[model samples]
Target: MQRFVSERILVQVGLLIVAVALFASTFGQSFSSSDLAQSPMFFPRIILVLWIGLGVISLIQSFKSDEKTRQIASWPRIGIVLVAALIYTNLIGSEGFFIPSVGFAVISLLAFGIRNPILVLLFAVLVPGSLVLLFNHTLGMPLPTSRFSYFF
Candidate 1:
């Protein structure tokens, strides 16, 4: 009964939906037919749609959960991960993508209770490296330029 709703997931989904809707409204305020294909509304429309989908999924899964009891993760751990992510974003432009991203991942993994150094290191490197390659190289989507200019 108590476990029916995954409270944390629900809260996040709701917040995301609200944020997307707000941004979509703000950005789409002046959208018109004459605008180009990649107008301001384009990205907001995509995000809003995805946010709605996520919210719906979260709502359904939470209502349909079959478990009678479950161990909810500690809020402190999630808070730590969120803080680490903020730090990563703040540092990425000044330090570099690799260093800040790896630090963020490692800290997040540790917060989530994965204590193995090898696994943490692997994840820290792999995820950020893949993102850097895919977004920066393959897609040509420029990320924040690392002030140190160490790697692409």
Candidate 2:
């Protein structure tokens, strides 16, 4: 019980450190007054601040808690998803968005214990397809494309 609490405390501290680092990284970003609201750094700064605040709160709570609760977390699943995301990031530029994103979605869902093949297939296709359409057409943002670009 004590070991579990200590482990959770370590995780909370790690998260707090990461959040602080992210918040600090945003300080070097410069945004013009005219485009401050539309600046690329604006949203990230906001999110990082919120993340830091949450980390602080969680860290405080972890130290204050007396409950002897044991949490069962799937750390391997997390690792798999992280690795898949890294691969997906690399593939987006080389293999284009559709194939890599579908693969990522499928792998991530499966890693998280989703077993329904039909649902997984639907999500793998629909999510990326919708995002491609929304970003490419509606938002006018161009995504990476391969030789089969015409299909999208």
- What CA RMSD would you report for each candidate? 8.4, 7.7
Poorest lDDT segment (10 consecutive residues) of candidate 2: 26-35
lDDT of each: 0.75, 0.86
Q: What's the TM-score of every candidate structure?
A: 0.46, 0.51
> Lowest lDDT 10-mer window, candidate 1?
1-10
In terms of TM-score, the best-performing candidate is 2
| lDDT, model 1, position 124 | 94
Question: How well does candidate 1 match the true structure in TM-score terms?
Answer: 0.46
Best by lDDT: 2
Q: Candidate 2: list runs displaced more than 4 Å.
A: 1-72, 150-152
lDDT of 2 by residue, 1-152 (tens): 66445877888878888888887887776667537787777888788888888988887777788754576588899899999999999989988999899999999999999999999999999999999999999999978986788774
